[model samples]
Target chain A: MRATGDTWPHMAGAAAQPVRRATVATLPAVKMLRRALVALSLAGTIAGLLRMRGKGGVPPQEGGWREVGVPPQ
Target chain B: MTTPIVGLAGCGVTGSRVLHHLAAHQVRVAVYDPSPALARNTRVVRLESAADLMACDLVVLCGPAPHAPLTEMLVADATPVVSVGDDLDDMQALLALQPLAERHGVAAVVGAGMAPGLSGLLARYLAAQLHTLDELHVAVHGTAGPQCARQHHAALGDAALGWHDGEWIQPPGGSGRDLVWFPEPIGAHDCYRAALPDPLLLQRGFPTAQRISARVSATRRDRLTARLPMLTPPHAAGDLGSVRVEARGAGPHGERVSVIAGVAGPTAELAAVVCAATVGQLLRHPVAPGVHALGDEALAGLDLLHHATQLGVRVQEFTGVARATSW
Candidate 1:
C-alpha cells in the first residue's frame, strides 16, 4: 500500500497517535482509528455486495467476474 | 523504466477498448475475467481472479459494480482505482479513500467511464466558467443491452441517489420523463430519468455545481421514464443504452448558458475514450484535492474536446440554460 501523506482526513480521533497513523494506513492498521475505517469500509462493502446479490447483481468472484478481454473467434 | 501496468475487469466492450488503448500506449496491461476468448491486445493477461488487479499501478473496473467490496482488499497502497460500469461501489470506496489519496499523494479517479466519468468531466468544465454556479443538469442515453443486475447480487439494493436541491435526494417512486435528447449518429433520442440528476458526484468533485444529472435516453419520448420512487439502484437494462448530457447555468445577465455533450456508440469505445481522457488529463496536470469530475481539471482543455470530437462525442455550447430546451 502507498503511503497517503495527508490527503485523507484520517478518522476523527486519529490525530493524537501521529506515529501510529503514519506507520500503518494500509490494511493492517497500526492505529485503532485507521483499523476502524478499514473495518467499516469492509463492512459497507459486504452489505452493499449482499444487497446487490439479492437483485441478481454480479457477485464478487463469480463467472461474470471472469476476465474476458477477447471475444470468441 | 518499464511501462505502467493496468488491470482491467470485465473485458467486454468498454473494457476491451480500454485494454487496447493501454496496450497501444505501451502500458503493460493485464486482465481478470472468467471467460477465455478476449480482445487482441499487446500484453493480454489471463487472471485466476480479480486479485490480479493488485499487481498493477492502476486498476480500471469495467464490469458490474458489486465489485466495490473488492476495492478495499484489491486496491493496496498507492494504487488508485477507476470504475467504468454501472456499479459505483468503486467510486464510493474511492471517495472513502479520498482524504488518504489526497493527503498521501495516491491517485484514485472514480466513475472513469462514459456517463458518470464524462458526466464528472462535464462538471469540471461547467464549474470552471460559472461565476456563482448553483445548478447543473446532465443527461445520458447510450448503451446497447440490458444493464440488468447479475442475479442474487445484493449490493445493488441501494437506490440511485444524486446530490440535488441542496443535499443528496434519493427521490422515491419511478416516474418517466418526456425528454428529447440530441444524440450523435441519430438526432433527438428520447430519454428519461433512469436515476435522479446523476450529477451528484459534483458535490464532492466539483464545488460549483448545486446539482447535475446524467439520465438515460430512449427511442421515443417518455417511453422509459420511471417513477423516481420506483427507480431502484441502476439495474442492467435489457436493451442497448444511449445517453446525452447538457450542462446548464444562469449567465450573468439573467441569461442561461449551457454546454451539451452527446456521445453515441457501443459502451466500450465511449468508456475507453472517457477513461483514457480522464487518465490522460490527470497524468498531464496535478489534480487538486476534494472529489472531482472527469472534466474537473485535466479534461477541460482542447485535447479532450478534439479526442471526443474525433470519436464522435458532440459538445455544444448554448445561450440559455433551460430544462425546457431539453426533450
Candidate 2:
C-alpha cells in the first residue's frame, strides 16, 4: 500500500523516523513504537478521507480533516 | 476493565476511526498496515503478516475489499475477522476461514462498515418491533470534499448489492427508489437507490424482511452511480463529503418507518468514526464464534453509536441518543 505522500505542506520530509518508502520495514522495538504511534495517530486523524486512498490498498482515507473530538494525527 | 485488544488489518479511514474510538476508552490495539504513517498513534506493532494475529482478541478487516488472500491470511487459529466488505465473494472467502477461526475459538463478523454497520443494527432493531417486518429499504447520500475524493476515488465506484424480496436482485445504481433524509446540515435531501436493503449480511441477519435495498443519491455524478460497482472511467474527481443512511421499513398494518443515520466530517474523519465503533464493538461484546456479520449481537447497532457518542464522535440518528431533540 502507498503511504501518505507529500500532501500537507511541511509534511513531505520530516526527520523524526526517516520514513523510507519502497524499502520494507527494518526498525527495532523502540523506533517501531514511535513510528507505530505516529503512523496510527495519523491514520486515526484521516480515517474517512483515506477510506478512498489511491488504488494501492494504502490508507483509503489519508491526510487532513479529523473527526471533531478525536485527536489529531 | 480494559477491552480486549483488536487487530486492524487496514489502518485507512475506517480502521483509524475504529482505533480512535478504542483509544478514547484506553483500548489498546495491535494493527498491521503497510503504511507506517497511518499507524503512528495507537498501540500499533510491526508484525510479519496477518497469520501472526498479533495478540488481539478480535480482528477487523477494514478498507475497501482488500485482496482475498490478505483477508484469509488474517483469519488464523484464534482471530475472527469483522469484515467491512461483504458480498458472495466475501462470504465464500470468509467461509474458507471458518475452520481456522473455529479452531481458535474465533468467529468472523462480515460487513461491518457504515452501511452494513448501522443498517444491520436497524434490521435487528426493527425486526424486534413487530410480529414480523415486511420490507427494509435503505438509501444513502454521501458527499465528500474534492481533496479527499481526489486521492481515493475508487470507493465511490463500489456498487452496494444486498438481499431483496425472497430472491436476489441486482438493481441498477440509480434504479432504487428515491428517498428524503432529515440530516443536520443537509436537510431533506433526496437519496438514490442502492444495491439492497442493508449491507450483504442483512440478508441473513434481518429476521423476516421480505425485501431490502441499499441505495445512494450522492452528490457525485448520477451516471457514475450505477457504475459504482463496474469497471469504467470515473465521471468526476476529488470532493470529500458526508454520508447518511435513510432506512424505510414496512411493518404490520402497513406501519411505515424511515430512519436516517450518518457521519459529517472531512471524509477521513468520518471514516475514522466508522472504524472506531466497529473495532470497539468487536472487543466489548460477547463476540460469538463462527462467521458473524455486522448486525450480529456483538456490534449492537445504535448501541455502538451510543458508545461512540460518549467518546465524542459525531453521529446523527432519528431516535435513540442521536434523536433530533439534541439537534
Candidate 3:
C-alpha cells in the first residue's frame, strides 16, 4: 500500500514509537465511541419514527429544482 | 458548421429524459426503440432499427446493457458514441473498445451517467484544488429507473473492484460500511462497497491516485435482501437520488485536506443532463479518437459541469461550519 504521508505525518522514524503506542492505546476507546454514536443515532431514528406514528404519518416532501453553482462563501 | 444529428437508443425512463433534454437544447435527434408506447415527439425522427442510428454523427446509448454490440457497430462505423451504462461488466466491455475506436478514429465515452459520470467529473474537479490527490471515495444514494434499481440490487451481491496503492483489489460486495454525508434533503446515508464502475472509470482518469473506492447507500433491509430476488417490482421511476464524491490529498500548503462535493436531483434527470452536456462537449470540442471516461484529463471537467449546470443540475460542496462551543 502506498504510504499516506499526509495522513500520518507523525508516524515515521524512531521518534514515532511513542506516538504509535499512544494511538494503539486509544484504538479501543475510539471504537467504543464510534459504536456508541451508531447506537445513539439508531435510537434517535426509532424515536423519531414512533413520534411520527403518533401524528398522521410522514409527509412527502416534493423536491424542487435549485439554481446551479456553488453557494457564495 | 451544421449541427450533428444525434441518435438515441432506448426510450426507457432514463432514455426518455435524455431525449427531452436534447430536444430542449434544439438538437435534432433520431430515436431507435421498439416500444409501441413511445410518445410522438415532433423533434425526434423515429428509426426502424438500431442499424439506422449509424447514419447519425453521434449515438448516445441509454439502453439496458450488454450495449457492446450496438456500441461496437456505431464506433466501427466511425460514429462517435456515448453510453450511460453503469453496470461494471458492461462498462468493462465498453472500455475494451478503446482499440477499435482508435482504429476507426471514433471517440466513445462509457459510463456517462449519474454515478460514474458525474462522480468522476466531481472527483476531477476536487482534485484540481489539491497539490497531490491520492484518494477518491464515491457514494451514491437512490436509483433512477427500474433498470437502475435492478442493477443496484444485483451489484450488492457482485464483487467490488477498488484501486489501492498501485494495484487493483476485489473486495466482497456490500462490505466496508461508511457513513457518507451528502448535500441536504439527502443528508447522511450509510454506504457500503458495491460493484460500481466509478472506481474503474476514475482510475482511468486519475491513474496516479493511490486509492479509489465506490459505494452505494443502503439500508439494513436493502443489504439483507440483496442476495435474494426482489420481493417487489421496482418503481417505474424512483425518487430523487444523489452522488457524493470525496477527494483527499495534500493541499496547496502540503497539509492533509479532503474536499467533498455532490449533485442531487432525480437520478434520471441528472443522468440525462450529463449525457446531454457530454454530447454538447463532444460536438463542440471533439476529443481524440479513443474510448474515454468523463474524468479523463483531455475533457475539461469544469466546462462539462458548467454545461450541466445550465441544463439544471445543481452542484453542492460541503463547506463545514465551526461548531458552537457552548451549544
Candidate 4:
C-alpha cells in the first residue's frame, strides 16, 4: 500500500532486523528498575491529565460563534 | 500558474489544520475572524470582516451554527463555501442557504470533516458498486485527548437520528451501542449512536438504501468520562483513530464492501486534509451553483477516496461476503 510522507505519524518505518532469542541470564535488579520507570511515567501522565481541569462552567461562547482558527505560523 | 487565493472563515482545530495543508499546497489564503487579535497572529492576510473574504476564489467555513448569518452573507455574494464542522447543525445551515446558493449560482459543500465527511462519501462510493443496496453502516472509533473527549460526551449526550425501514427515527441508544469490530489494534469496541449527519445525508443521496446508521466509540477512559462528564480522565486511547464504512447490498450475487480509513495523528489533521483537498478540487472545477453535501455536486469532480488515500489516510476495501451477512 502506498503511504503519504510524514503526514501520518503511525506509518513510520520500523528498523529492519532479524529476530533474536531471549537470553536466560535475567537481571532482577534491572527488571525492577524498568518497572519503577514505567510506574513513574504512568504517574506523570495521570498528574498531567488531572492538571487539565476546565474552568468552572462552560465558557459563554463554546467557540460556537467564535473563530476557532489556528495561525499558519 | 497563479496561486488561487482562498478565504478561511475560522481558524480553530479543523480550520487551522485546513490552513496548514492549504499553505503547504501553495494556495494563497486570506483569513477572516471577528477577533482582530486572532487575525493578527496568522501568517495569512487578515480581513476586516466576513464580507471581505468574498474577494477570494472560495471560502472554507469552520465557524459555529451561530455564524449562519456570516454564511448567509457569503452565499448572497455568490461565493462558493465549504463547511467543515458540526454535521447536524451544518446541514440545517446549508438547507437555509440553498435558495441563496441557487440564486447566486455558487456551490456550498456541507459536512466536510472526518466522520460525516469521509463516512458519507465512502458510503456513496461503495453503493455505486452495488446493484441494490439494502443497508449501510458507518462506525467511528477515536483515540483522542480531553479536547475531543468533551465533544464526544456532548454528542452521545444528545439524541441521535438514524434511518431504518425508510424513515428517520431515534435509535434506542443514540449510538448503535453494539460491538463493532474496526481494523486491528482498534479491534472490537462498543459503539453508541451519534448525531452524525451521514445517515441523514446518505439516505437522501441514496434513496434506495433501506437502512443507514452511524455510531462512534472512544477509549475505555474516554467512553467512561463521556458518560460521566465530571471525571476528567487521562487519555487511554493514545493518538490513533479509524472510520469504517460498510455497505451490504446485491451486486450480481449478494456482496458487501467494507472500508476502514485509519489516521495516525489527530483526527483534525485528517479533517483538514479533507477540507483542503475539497478546496483544491473546487478551485480547479467550479460546480454548478447550489447546496450540496460531501457526496453532492460540488464535490462531483473529486475522487474523494483517492485523494484521501494519497494524504496518508489508510483505506482498505474488502468485498464478496455471504448473502445472509450482506443484509
DockQ of each: 0.01, 0.02, 0.06, 0.01
Output the TM-score of candidate 4: 0.71
Every model's TM-score: 0.63, 0.61, 0.80, 0.71
Q: Write the per-residue lDDT of candidate 1 for residues B20-91, one digit (tens) a residue.
A: 776666666778877555634435676678776777776777766555565545444556666664554445
- Writing each residue's lDDT as its tens digit, candidate 4 over B45-67 gives 88787778879878998754444
User: In order, what lDDT does every prediction score?
Assistant: 0.54, 0.53, 0.85, 0.67
Candidate rank order under TM-score: 3, 4, 1, 2
Ranking by lDDT: 3, 4, 1, 2
Which parts of model 1 are misplaced by more than 4 Å? Answer: A1-73, B39-43, B88-90, B100-104, B144-160, B218-242, B281-292, B297-327
Task: Give the C-alpha miss distance for residue B262 in model 3, angstroms.
Answer: 0.8
Return the lDDT, model 1, position B189.
50
- The segments of candidate 4 whose C-alpha lies over 4 angstroms from its true place after superposition are A1-73, B1-3, B34-42, B64-67, B143-149, B172-175, B218-239, B254-265, B318-327
> TM-score of chain B, per candidate?
0.75, 0.71, 0.95, 0.84
Better of 2 and 3 by lDDT: 3
Candidate 3 per-residue lDDT, tens place, A1-73, comes to 6566555676654355553445345588899999999999999999999877674543323332233363222
The DockQ assigned to candidate 1 is: 0.01
Docking quality tier of candidate 3? incorrect
Instruction: For candidate 3, give the lDDT of residue B127.
Output: 90
For residues B111-199, could you state the per-residue lDDT of candidate 3 as single tens digits? 88998899988897889888999999999998888989999998998899999998999998889988776777787688999999999
